[model samples]
Target: MKKITLWLAALCGGAIMLSGCNMLDKANGIILYGDEEKVLSSLKEEHKGQVEKDSLSVKLMDTDGKRLMIMDETSAQYLLEKELLQEVKDGRDTEALSSIPKLAEGEAFLFAKKEDSDIGFDSLPDQVNYEGNVIIGDGRAYADMFLVVADEDFTAFEAEAKTMGIIQYNKDPDGIGGFDVEREQLVKIEE
Candidate 1:
């Protein structure tokens, strides 16, 4: 009986250590806004292409008319369209979003419904910047989601989880994997 208990305790300790290590690996790096000036400077340095701007956003497109990026002034975000990302992954335009900084490696962008005031990043730290609300989802069931740039070491995730609720969101239908979010522990939405 004593040996069995010791073995079980060792197993539990190993699991806990594994989970802690996984969390550390997912630790977010610095979350910075996509500045238009920085983007333009990079573009000029790389000699990519021209930029088009309307009242809504500033667009950067390649000479072949492939939309590379969109910088939303209101939200202060640089979004890479999905089509471009796919093309790049398929070995077509390998240098598609190279101009933009690749600071989103370990970080995860967790959003909350703007209407859900009861649950949100109320006490965001000085490092985490609220980047305004933006519309998410492509279907008719669109949602107004609030955005925030979480700091490195996931301090924002910890703060939000303590104040609101955190959930794991699985975006793909293949059941591959998911990321942590606020409000619920698990959610799988087909896209």
Candidate 2:
């Protein structure tokens, strides 16, 4: 199931972007799947020597500790609708109690969810409650790895990504030619 999800993300992310970043809502977080062993390509030729499959998993790391978590999209959406999020007329202000990994090369992300368990671990099953995907700020980067940020924090994430030489910012409204990551600054596309 996990491998299938990652494959879907890799296959779909590119296609989704082609529809234009306009399809994304800067204020909302999205479900993402990424393979750690694979480096992302702005160009296709660089992918020649890499193996096609890698194990994909969701993870969470913070002051408390790091652990493997579950992905439950419906649960995520429920959390958003039930009013667990911090009120912000523009962009979401909720904290990511749990997250999963996605993105490529140095770019990576942790799809978000609320920690609603007594143990505060893992994905919530449907009978209980669910958490929705939320955009998390910069993930801890290592070597060539990078992080993905929500529309709420695009400006700040952009500045940090630049310093790290990470050139991509998904769904930046200010992106240029659909390859906004190549641009020095973003031009937020209005809905």
RMSD of 1: 19.7
What's the TM-score of each model vs. the native?
0.21, 0.19
> Against the true structure, candidate 1 has what lDDT?
0.27
Model 2: per-residue Cα lDDT over 1-191, one tens digit each: 99999999988998777644444434221112233222122222222222221122222222234333332233323333322222221243334333333222233233333334232333222233223334322222221111232223333222212111122233332322332122222212111
Q: lDDT tens string, model 1, 164-188?
A: 1111222212211221221111111
Model 2 residue 157 lDDT?
Answer: 26
lDDT of each: 0.27, 0.29
Give lDDT for model 2.
Answer: 0.29
The alpha-carbon deviation from the true structure for residue 14 of candidate 1, after best TM-score superposition, in angstroms, is 65
